[model samples]
Target: MGATVVQLTESKKQIQHTHRTFDDQTKAFRSNPMPSISERRENLKRLKRLILTNQERLIEAIDRDFSCRSKDETLIAEVMPSIQCINYTLKHLDGWMKPSKRHVSMLFQPASNQVHYQPKGVVGIIVPWNYPLYLAVGPLVASLSAGNRSMIKMSEYTPHTSALFKEIIEGSFPGDLVSVITGEADVAADFSAQPFDHLLFTGSTSVGRLVMKAAAENLTPVTLELGGKSPAIVSPDVPMEDAAQRIAFGKAFNAGQTCVAPDYVLCPSDRVQAFVDEFRTRFSEMYPSIRDNDDYTAIINERQYARLQSYLDDARAKGAKIIEINPARENLGDGTRKIPLTLILNTTPDMKVMQDEIFGPLLPVVGYTNLDEAVHYINERPRPLALYFFGYDRGQQQYVVHQTHSGGMCINDALMHVAQDDLPFGGIGDSGMGHYHGKEGFLTFSHHRAIFTKQKFNSGQFVYPPHGTSLHKMIYKLFIR
Candidate 1:
């Protein structure tokens, strides 16, 4: 009973701290609402320096959190992208900050109209566990670039990395400008309920709904980066080796914990076996050994491992053929949390693996007889975060692009669309809501305030209060037509 009381007290204290931090950030934003471009640039530079200086430490922390995360994967997927985003933002901040000149109708001649992008005050960022560092840094880059003070809520599943992130951010930034919140689920709920200017969440779809609900209470605008079952379609004419190799790379990277990872493959019905064989070969070549291999990344935790294992069991019981691509055939059962790249063939819509977002190293291969079948299959479900089509035919590509819906797409490739710094990344329906990568990111965090200036002459006065006046009638007759 005493311990329970102590825990309750601590929870209350953390909640209080979260509220205080948010209020502080709000106050700070009001004091210096729109920071100068130089200030924003300096903030980005400081962030880049912090990441570079502590790159090894951050990598080690994530490794500890995952038990066996690949250092190379961390560098390529997380650190590199974070730094690249900062560089991209710094290079284009000036152009994005310039007020956009807008056209005015002839009736309003002698007046100048433009759109000024103003910061949206304080922003709230909720980071998920799969790619904690990059997800946090990506949104932070956008928020800072738009000159908004932000508070980040790091996932509790990644304790080591989260704690280190909070510490490092505290050292580099003032508490009122940028703060990192770390706690349990209750704390996250409280954080979500805060009255933020804008909230950006990166996580699963189920949790995203709850976050949106909490944000709605405050009428806070949100940019949800939720994950769904992103699919990859292979054309009949495309070489099996090319399609398989690229799809295998996308699935095996970070052990398929990526939000944009290819969840399933929609292959030509006649070439299923050939594509499967090539995928197995390519995956084996990428990592010859799963157990005790530094190149192979393990699942984040035991809970996630069990979840994936259950998915395989359920799929197997539902008459799906399971293929495990373990080149060394080593025993990975000693709580290593390492799962080899597994493929599920003969999947049905009823199976859990097919119904849910397979955010692990499990890929399901679904057969399609024609292009219409493939397009219909995808359209029947909620729009995915990404869709990959493996074909070189320009007409076929155009047809697919026009007929299908996804947050993003890569023709003749997989998972590379997100690495491009110029493209806007987001989803449509169930996958997610708003874009936040390049210029879109800056705009998402800014309010496009329209401004109209007229020198000495008032054009709107002619149409003012008194109705049917000679001037008003003349203006109406001249313009309303």
Candidate 2:
């Protein structure tokens, strides 16, 4: 019990230290509230240079955390997007900073109106484990571009990457300018409880609720980037081979750990077998061997691996047809963390695989009789982070767009919409809320201040303070109509 008391005291000290650091950063923001455009650009350049110079080290650290994260996957999914976001912000930030003039009515002819974008103070970003680098840096790019200081809370799950990021940030910028915090769930809870100008969280919906609840204590505005069961629909007009390969790429990338990864596929009832065959073939071509394949990514840890295995077991016990796609026919249970990509057919709504967001490489293929059925099936559930439609028919695409609601949508492609610098990325309903990307991101972290100016001319003195004069009658007649 004495040892426990010592441990408790140490933990209390750690929490107090973190709180003090947050207060110091808040005070720093007060010291220099607004930074000039040149200063903001310089900060962004420093960040880009740091990442580019240490690209190899960051990749290795992430790989070590995940046990076997593909280096190419990190480059494509994390590094490339982060660098592109920085460059995109640099190219358009000047225009984004400029205020827009508004038209003033003739009645108020002497006055002019304009909306200026100003930075909110300090922002808090909560990073998730799956895509640690991109999720952390993505929001930082937006926060800095808007000229706001920020503090990032890295996930405890990815310790190697989190520790490395903290060190890199310390070396790159002052703690008050930008800081990184690393700790377990208790630390995260304390971090979220602190009052920030704005808070951005990217993780599961269940956890998002908890973060939001904590943020509510301070009435802090929040931007939630949560995940749900995103679906991929294959139109009857599209060929099975084309649809299957694209969908396979979306599901197989990151071993299906991405927030916007395709959770399931909706195939026409008559073409289910053909689609399945094509998907298996495409997955094999991409990864010939699962056990020893460098291209194939392993699940992050034993807990998640076991959870996915349990999902499969629960589905199989419910009489669903489970097809494991092991092209090399390797032993999956011999102490390897990598699980062969498996496809579950004949899934029911009652099955666990159909109920939860399948974050693993398991795909549940649902056969729908028509497009309306697929759309209805999706609409019946909570809105997803992304929805994919594979077809060239413009009418059908528009119909799907009008009929369904999601955070974002991709036509004839998968997972590419999030990469577009011009589009806003976010989720709706249970998936999440608020957008952060491109101009929307700038606006998300900015306060659009409305200003009005009037000339020294005195036109309103004619009707000043009189009960009902001829001028007042005339003015009322002219303007009130």
Over 205-249, each residue of candidate 1 has an lDDT whose tens digit, in order, gives 999999999999999999999999999999879988899999999
The Cα RMSD in angstroms, rounded to one decimal, for candidate 1 relative to the true structure is 1.3
Model 2 off-target regions past 4 Å? 1-14, 458-464
Q: Which 10 consecutive positions of candidate 2 have the poorest summed lDDT?
A: 6-15
**How well does each candidate superpose onto the true structure, as a TM-score?**
0.98, 0.96
Top TM-score hit: 1
Model 2 misses residue 45 by how many Å? Answer: 0.5
Error of 2 at 305 (Å): 1.0
